[model samples]
Target: MRSSPRLFQYACRITLFTRQNCSLCVNAKQVLSTVWDKHPFVYKEIDVMTPDAKGWQDLYEFDVPVIHIAKTEHGLERPELSAKAQKLMHRFSAEQVMEKMDIISDPKS
Candidate 1:
């Protein structure tokens, strides 16, 4: 039987805000690719340079690969993915990084 994604161990949504031909953004995407391949999560790339994306300019103008996570009302006491991933892998063999990605992509929030 197929299980609901919401019931998974952990789920993270990684969103990358970048511009065209930005070297740092390229590197960040590469890193995220590796991370995705190693985990069970979803990722999205956004070009804030686009006119329609101006709304995000104020918060992440300089931070191209800004990451955010969803919380369980507690507001994510500590939203450090790398550290949390490491700890999880140490305890379980599955060690799915994607399952732990608690990111938000919509700039409206």
Candidate 2:
């Protein structure tokens, strides 16, 4: 996968499922903010406790700070893209997230 570095993280939308009082969620937001500052993307936050959270509350109530990275509408659920392609959960860094994004963008690399 020979392409621009910017191409990897671009066009990716991140859906962050969180709870109101989760400290891990707070930290995850901070890390994601750092990544956004460098390379902006479509970032959406869904509070599991919110009434309008759709189905996120039931899916991730016990798993605060769960992050789903996708290039298109809710694709790439499999973690087999590599270790880097696994769904980010609990504790993660900007680098880990970026690596996953890169693999997602160019899986043949």
Candidate 3:
């Protein structure tokens, strides 16, 4: 009997919006680091205070240190985030990140 081929799934990338001198951002990074130890997802940090990030700063002024899971695609330098992916606050716990990862990873979600 022939066995079916195994399928491999690509890991999702996460974006962290942060700013300098922000205690919340610091705490969020720590939490994310802890979660990443187990979940293992690529993450990028965006400094909203930077001049190049004007748009991001305006949009997330009150929501600093936002965490967003990037949308997956076959080829793209920076994949767009899915509409279903909700922006998480900096206060989110490791467990919450895990739950979000599960939701984002689910094909049906």
Candidate 4:
């Protein structure tokens, strides 16, 4: 079966869910700050303490450095990012990033 190239080409949207006073979250923020500037994509952090951020508390109380991708349709529950999210951040888009890295893909396989 032939697959649509556009679907394969879709860039992943990463939404970093975090809270105050979390060491991991702090570290994640620092890494994102340094790298995202080059990628040219927005990374937002939501504090679980805020009233508006209540919805995040259940899933993130123990896991403070949860990263949610917008691709999930049924909210930010399942399919949460793994520990390797740090490494994956480097896979950001080169077309928009300051330092461009050639991304090669084979459609015919």
Candidate 5:
């Protein structure tokens, strides 16, 4: 799991579930990189193909390039995040991610 140290635990955490040699995963990664550079959130990339990543692989075996945006200021995920923490599947765009990020940063949204 790779991340940016600058982003504290309280910040929004973006988790990207991906695998090797997948065109969609590569494309997702590129888009995520663009979003990350623009927003500078706590980003993490997990390769589902890894031996220890079996958990994620099991859930997303057929669905690669899954993204989860979690906002946990206390390091505890709130299931009530209607928009704060959202899962993005398949192909997505930076604009879509930015929208989600906006909601995460603004609780009133």
Candidate 6:
């Protein structure tokens, strides 16, 4: 008997730590959406004010728009980021976010 081959898809989860009435958070979401148009991935928005994000408020209070990209594979999560990307996480532009996404998604990099 012959068996068919199964194909696996590569996906990453992008979490945006944001707060209500935050201008930076809005800008971040807009940038992320632009990036998503080219390289799509699972996107999640987390509000620091909620109970679910209790501890995060302390860490990301001032950093209203933080992005975390983690790969999902075989039920395991792994972060994919370069040193430059990490530095850009704090304060970055749409172009910078796209650049980071390209770096993380590129298999050869």
Question: For candidate 3, lDDT tens digit of each residue in 3-108?
Answer: 3322126466678889988899999999999988997777789888889877778767778878887434423323232234546886889898888877767766
**Superposed model 6: Cα runs more than 4 Å off:** 1-8, 74-91, 106-109
lDDT of each residue in 10-101, candidate 4, tens digit only: 33345666777777776666665665565433345666667877666665666766554432222343324333232223223323222221
The whole-model C-alpha lDDT of candidate 3 against the native structure comes to 0.72
Which sections of candidate 1 miss by over 4 Å?
1-9, 71-109
The deviation in Å at residue 102 for candidate 3 is: 0.6
Best by lDDT: 5
Compose the digit string of candidate 2's lDDT tens values, residues 1-109: 5767656444677878788889999999999999888766678777878887646676778978988876644454432432343369999999988877666566454
Worst 10 residues of 3 by lDDT: 74-83
Q: What are the models' TM-scores? A: 0.55, 0.73, 0.78, 0.50, 0.74, 0.69
Q: Which of the two, 4 or 6, has more lDDT? A: 6
Find the 10 residues in a row with the least total lDDT in model 6.
76-85
lDDT of each: 0.48, 0.74, 0.72, 0.47, 0.75, 0.63
Higher-TM-score candidate of 1 and 6: 6
**Model 2, runs deviating above 4 Å:** 1-10, 72-86, 107-109
Clashing pairs in 4: none
How far in Å is the alpha carbon of 25 misplaced in model 4? 1.2
Clashing pairs in 5: none
- Please give the range of 10 consecutive residues that has the lowest summed lDDT in model 4: 100-109
TM-score for candidate 5, residues paired by index: 0.74
lDDT of 6 at 52: 66
Model 5, residue 96: displacement in angstroms? 0.5
What is the alpha-carbon RMSD of candidate 2 to the true structure?
A: 5.7
Between candidates 5 and 6, the lDDT winner: 5
